[model samples]
Target: MIKKHLIYKKDKWNMLTVEVNGKTLILREISDQWGEECHTFLSRPAMMHWVEERFPKEQFEGSEEEWTAIMQAFKEV
Candidate 1:
């Protein structure tokens, strides 16, 4: 059986927990920014710099707001 639960951790983050059989998939909001400029100006080095300088994470990192802004500047297909 597959069960889905929608959970909100905060205003900018969410958790979608899905269970199938005995397996669980935790799809977190992790990062929200996934737009145009991100795909354009942000390279791996740039991203690493931004993540390191602005956001610190134990496991994950990056500026979700930047992603959002870039995404807003572009269109999703």
Candidate 2:
């Protein structure tokens, strides 16, 4: 089962936790932006980068289901 728990929502962004295989991974959603313009879906690269940069100490690697859950979490959050 996929479980989504909201961490927080501030301004135009929302942070959530998605559980997969009994482990929880962080996922975030924000108003999409491209180049010098704002658009519709959040950037996947940006989301991965944020997790890597801010939580460098974490040994994070995602499974296929985890990735799916992350995407769904962003959409539903």
Candidate 3:
């Protein structure tokens, strides 16, 4: 299961922290943006296209299924 902690943002991106097992991820949403929390995942070939376009240097990790579930959970928020 993923555990989350809400974080306050002051002139910064809103943050949501999700921890699975012992791994922790900080998902950020820009101020004024709404939707699921933000987190990082290793970008796949197709995903890398956009990841690179927006965040060329962003780092990604985790299995394919793990990422899928994470995204789904974000949508639930």
Of candidates 2 and 1, the better by TM-score: 2
**Lowest-sum lDDT 10-residue window in model 2:** 32-41
C-alpha local distance difference test of each model: 0.33, 0.43, 0.44
lDDT of 3 by residue, 1-77 (tens): 66554332335454444333334444454544675555554423333343345333234354666455545454443
Task: Extract clashing residue pairs from model 2.
Answer: none
Which model, 1 or 3, shows the larger lDDT?
3
In model 2, what lDDT does residue 9 have?
Answer: 40
Instruction: Order candidates by lDDT, high to low.
Output: 3, 2, 1
lDDT of 2 by residue, 1-77 (tens): 55555533434533444333233344434433421222222454555566446334334354566655554554553
Report the lDDT tens digits of candidate 1 across residue range 37-59: 11112233443354344334433
Error of 3 at 13 (Å): 20
Which regions in candidate 2 have their CA more than 4 angstroms from the true location?
11-26, 32-52, 55-77
Clashing pairs in 3: 27-38, 42-60, 42-61
